[model samples]
Target: MSTPVLVINSGSSSLKYQVVDADDGGALAVGLVERIGGSGHGRLTHTVDGEKHRSDVAVPDHAAAMAAMADAFEQHGPDLAAAGLVAVGHRVVQGGARFGHSVRVDEAALEIIEELSALAPLHNPANAAGIRVAMDTFPDLPHVAVFDTAFHLTMPEVAHTYAIDRQVAADHRIRRYGFHGTSHAYVSRQAAELLGKPLEETNVIVLHLGNGASACAVRAGVSVDTSMGLTPLEGLVMGTRSGDIDPAVVFHLARTAGMDIDAIDDLLNKRSGVLGLSGSQDMRDLVDAVEAGDADAQLALEVYCYRVRKYVGSYLAVLGRVDAIVFTAGIGENADEVRELSLRGLESLGIEVDGEANRARSKEPRDIATAASRVRVLVIPTNEELEIARDAVRVTGS
Candidate 1:
């Protein structure tokens, strides 16, 4: 049996994990622990060897969640000891500019991740908690931190630097630190492989359009640019995030509308985007509503797709010669209507979608672009866990 790496993606109130064989990228087990410290009951579900096991309990914190996860492995099968676990790879959302790559967990590294909590208020704290709990649970096993921002560390300073005062920006570390780099890196490599081109020779524009969305421009296997800036809220319009809004709106709300900074922040981060526009954030629901002639839903879909299209155009210009435009994540890979709407007017840019291909449903990566199109358009499912496991293996030398 091969040693499998444990990959943990911790959120503010949930933890998702997978045990993956670093040799072949196969999942030995996959599970999720949700609603930790939330209002309702918490649940832990684990699946191994095609068998599913679930438990509903009060998971008060991440420590309890980690305990439940260890118990799940103990009860289900493939005991951690028998599986020859070599390392635990944690997904740290915001590494800032400090951690350019995955590093072995140490007190110093942990401190750096904690210091970065200010950059990712909703994510880094939870990630740090998961790391701490996992370290305690498997004190002997090597723990590695695979950062989401690590892949984007190759981005040029010109692309990452914001147009602001240099001293203030440096003092506060205020500059673009894109999120979703793990997904973008994985999908871009897959895209190149699908095109039968060397990764170093490929230039791709990847859109990860889940509830939290981002766009990345990868040129020759390096991140040249990305959408999210400073935080995850500055990219594509997400479920509740108002992406790419004018900065003056914050001050206007504070001065003119008598709203405080926190109120304005809450408004943009939690009460805006597609939900603010259509009253629902789920694309499936929005699509259904569009079919039923709901005007708000129709407008929301248009705005969402239009924003994606604009980014595609901007990234194409940035890349100069793009080989493919790849889409991943929930809405990107699954929503045919959104994909169609997004690439509608891109024909002149050597991008043309095959209507039938775009409408076809499949989990596998495949091209949806017409054969005559100069640039290929593909839907590649992202595998961030596999990427994390691979990085863990590399860093741990296991």
Candidate 2:
């Protein structure tokens, strides 16, 4: 019997799961359980026989959502009756300062993962709850915990360290813990593959821009620098969160404006960013507004692209000689305007994009670099779920 692994990525209200043939590292079935606690309704989409099965059901909790998913797979995919299920790979949000790599799940592991919840209050507890329920549902299957912070563990002291006082930092574990490890790792390797160069020999900058945006510097296939620091709230502006901000703004809003800490946090984390600047976070909306002569939208876009360009320039300096500059994720993959605008006028650094090629993205990786430029530019969609699944296979002893 061929060994199979299950990849489970649980969000606050979503569960992304897939069955993969570990031998070939190929996905067999993929689906998601969304709107766990909301009225949007729960649905499952599974691939089989070249067609997909989708259905709606009530999922008040992650456990129920996960159970429905297993039922869907058993009723839809390869046999689970006598099937010996291997390990389940869970996408754990915060492994904290303790774990630097994927580890086999155990009681102690779960406790430690829970302990780190204070650090990632929004993500870790929810992620841990999903893990616990999965363990209960599949008691016989070994599970692996893959962390988002594991890959960025390579960052040096100087880069990860904040400029704040040492005693406070040591007390609070306040240091840069870069997220999007799986995507950053995979995208960098793809960049190397596209260049037909050794993974350990080249440098590249990967812009991952989904709802939460970030920049990464891949030097010789390992992450050397990244924009996200201490939390996902840092770095480039995102869909709903203000990225970079003045440290004093928080205190000023509280003292002078009578805003409290919680209110300020909610405002920045939930109501700010492109949404705050232009009343919208979707790039499409911003672009349309700009075309229709909306000054605020145009300025929001300008600020977004300008920050990306600045990071590209800085990472280029950090790398010294980058082989390629890559873009991935939702906005990075589909927003040609953002890509083109960000890479524009970079000819002085040998980082020019071919205007025609930039606008002609299609299936498979293609170089969009200008014929005269030295660095190759590319648009590659990220699949962090696949990476998490692969890591799960390795850790579960499959």
Candidate 3:
């Protein structure tokens, strides 16, 4: 009954992979191949049995990366050919409206993924390329694509629809397609379980706070509304992304700063967020700066947490009656100060975080809410890889 599945998240120049056991919900092996196709040497880091193995080599392309990955498994641990891999799951960032759930990857499905690259110019092409190379490498294994956008497809039409020029918006497919859905789905289910309520009856607000953050309002285990819109660049203030900015800022910058489309995009996505306000992007660094009385860092933290609080309040309104609020991902899980600051002043709204519980250092999921609080506050660590693996197995009937 050991159903092992390999989950792949292919980036533009890097490949991250994990061999996850769907039955046990544990990662058997995890690895990363970085700097693919770069002019300099690439690096491969593979870990198994809590041991790390590293190698530096020339990874000229996805094909070379896949071969390197196979070599790592063969040489270090968990030989892939003998591992009984049920399927290979890929993390495709954009499924568009075409794919509402995980699907077995075929030539036709691959083509659709590639065609959707326009929606995720920076992600889908690399995903499709990796799928092509992975299929060539493991032709016998069933390959499945679990989209980050798929879970949010349940959003009602009013929630997803943009009130722009209807014809123009429709032609461009300009509707909200929230990201971080895999984490949202995984964390929301965990929240429901923690509440000891049927997932169908539980209403939870899931805040996936990583370098890229999003808030999802899950009513009856389905995404009703999310902070992100049309792209990852929207929603909460991310590490480097200016989330929820006025659209006219772009036009104003074009007219005044003479910035072009690409330049503006780079500014909003790479040079904004906490980095734009303070010279740092990492929450740890920002926290350090704030502790040291760095005014800019303090302001950055304020902006970040204020945005999160705004979404929490809005989602509270959306859900009407909530069961719990769950926080997951790197920042949400480890940054105690962030969790506290984000939920600050929400006590009147029935959301209160216990100081000691919030500050406790534990990896396991636990409640951080005060005993008297009406709504429970939870810190649930997200396991997106395991979620992907499980979805892959279910989709392929493996």
Residue 236 lDDT in candidate 2: 91
Which stretch of 10 consecutive residues in model 2 shows the poorest summed lDDT? 77-86
Top TM-score prediction, candidate number: 3
Q: After superposition, how far is residue 113 of candidate 3 from its true place, in Å?
A: 0.4
Q: After best superposition, candidate 3 residue 356: deviation in angstroms?
A: 0.5
Q: Is candidate 1 or candidate 2 better by TM-score?
A: 1
Model 2 residue 344 CA deviation (Å) reads 1.1
Q: What is the lDDT, from 0 to 100, of the residue 265 in candidate 1?
A: 89
The stretch of ten residues in a row with the least summed lDDT in candidate 3 is 57-66
Report the lDDT tens digits of candidate 2 across residue range 33-95. 888888767887777656788899789999889888888877887555455557788888777
RMSD of each predicted structure = 1.2, 2.0, 0.7
Clashing pairs in 2: none
lDDT tens digits, residue span 1-398, model 3: 89999999998999999999999998999999999999998999999999999999789998899999989999997988899999999999999999999999999999999999999999999999999999999999999999999999999998999889999998999999999888999999999888899999999999999999999999998999999888899989999999999999999999999999999999999999989999999999999999999999999999999999999999999999998989999999999999999999998999889999999999999999999999999999999999999999999898
Give each model a TM-score.
0.97, 0.94, 0.99
lDDT of 1: 0.93
